[model samples]
Target chain A: DVKVTQSSRYLVKRTGEKVFLECVQDMDHENMFWYRQDPGLGLRLIYFSYDVKMKEKGDIPEGYSVSREKKERFSLILESASTNQTSMYLCASRSGQVRGNYGYTFGSGTRLTVV
Target chain B: AQTVTQSQPEMSVQEAETVTLSCTYDTSENNYYLFWYKQPPSRQMILVIRQEAYKQQNATENRFSVNFQKAAKSFSLKISDSQLGDTAMYFCAFMKHEGKGTYKYIFGTGTRLKVLA
Candidate 1:
């Protein structure tokens, strides 16, 4: 079966430390996304990539950056981790279903804690 | 911009019973998609069901179905014969059909559903 996998299921980082959350999908999907889910705020998008070496900012991109050097792997980098960034970070990928409709397969989320 | 809303933050249902989770959205775009995703205690996001805006017929997937009222801008999920595994946080989402090749998933806060045995 096709899968979206996260390198880590949980992580704890110190404040001011750089953190990396990695996600890889085997479906060869063209779209990959990173979102941070918080209570009451829902899943806010941090960044997304539709092609390798290409990326775009989403609704919430502050304190975060992304790299898509390869098609299967998408990495989220927290340059300087802060307590406010502690939350469940989810990664998802979707292939082209059709012209107008698409669905996503999400990886098991990584719950990040910044102390 | 698209916005999704799940007014009910929490809900409960007895085993083997049926329950519906409510979702509403606001968007100017006439075409779009709506989805119901379940996040279990394991924190794995699973797609429960989906609805296409242009389709008048509500979608059904096994015991999980949807009540899609396009004119009402409401998409609710109904789980029949609720099972213990059905208990999770249900999220509603919206993605507008902008032809500019912009694809984004906008999500609702979520509804926590508990299935009691």
Candidate 2:
């Protein structure tokens, strides 16, 4: 089975600290995305990478940055963690080919709490 | 810009009963894809069903099916024989075929479904 693995399931970080959330996919999918899921607000996109070293900002990219050093791994970085930054983070990947698959396979998600 | 709306924030169904979750989208693009994704408690999100706007026929998988109304831009998911495992948050997503391989998806707020015994 194809899997998108997140490095951490739960994390607690202090304010002003830099936090990193890692996601790796074995599927070799060309597209990877980072989204923060909040209650009532649903999931908001943070960043997406289509290829190695290629990244695009999404709807809510503020206070967040992403790195895609390799095709299989995408990293989300919180430059300065704030209390409001605490939320459930999800990583997803999909085949870039528009023809075959349109669905995204998501990781179990990382729940980060900032204090 | 495209947007998806799931007006029903919460729903409940008895086991073995059927429940329908409503989803509506706003978009000018005629060619697009609609999807329903389910996220169980503490589990990864998974795709439940997908519908291509160009197709007139609704898509189905086992006890799960979709009611697609292209003219109204409404796509709803129906779950039959609901089980306890079916309790989860269901999201409606819309993706416009960019003609190229790269595109973004817009998701609804999501509907939480609880299965009652």
Candidate 3:
């Protein structure tokens, strides 16, 4: 079965620390995304990459950045971790081809805690 | 701008009973996609069902079905014969394709459903 694997299931970071959340997909999907899931806000997109070395800022990309050096790997970076940045981080991948299963395949998710 | 709304924050149903989760969206685009995702206590979100905007028929998957009213911009999920394992957070989502391989995905706040035994 195809899968999107998130490197860490949980992480704790100190304020001002640089944090990295890694996601790797074996499905060879062309589109990868990072989202922050909070209590009241379902899932807010942080960044998405449609191709290697390409990225676009989503609705909530204020304190985050992303890198897609290869087709199967996408990483989210927290420039300066803050308490407010603590939330469940999700990684998803999708096929660029429009013919089948257009819905995203999500990873297990990482719950990040910024202290 | 596109937005999805799940007015019901929490719902409950007895085992073997039926329940429905409500979802509404606002959009001007004629063609798009709608989806219902389930996130269990394990925290892994999975696709429960999907509906194509142009199709008049609602989508169904086993015991999970959808009530898609395109004119009303509403999409609701119905769980039949609710099972204890069905307890999870359900999210309604809207997807709009913007050409050049760019797409916008928006999700509702989500409804937490509990199936009592």
Rank order by TM-score, top first? 3, 2, 1
Number of the candidate with higher DockQ, 1 or 3: 3
Give the winner by DockQ. 3
Stretches off by above 4 angstroms in model 1 are none
TM-score of 1: 0.97
> Which candidate would rank higher by DockQ, 1 or 2?
1
Identify the runs in model 3 with alpha carbons over 4 angstroms from their true place: none
Give the per-residue lDDT of model 3 (tens digit) for B1-117.
889999999999999999999999999999999999999999999999999999999999999999999999999999999999999999999998899768789999999999998
- Candidate 2: TM-score? 0.98
Candidate 1: pairs in clash: none
List the pairs of residues colliding in candidate 3.
none
Using Cα atoms, each model's DockQ against the true complex is: 0.89, 0.85, 0.92
**lDDT winner, 2 or 3:** 3
Find the 10 residues in a row with the least total lDDT in model 1 chain B: B96-105
Candidate 1's error at B87, in angstroms? 0.7
Give the alpha carbon lDDT tens digit for every residue of B1-117 in model 1: 578999999999999999999999998877788999999999889888888888899999999999998888999999999999998999999987555566667999999999999
Error of 2 at B5 (Å): 0.6
Residue A62 of model 3: what lDDT? 98
Please write out the lDDT profile of model 2 over residues A1-115, one tens digit for every residue: 9999999999999999999999999998999999999998888999999899999999999999999999999999999999999999999999886674689999999999999
**TM values, all candidates:** 0.97, 0.98, 0.98
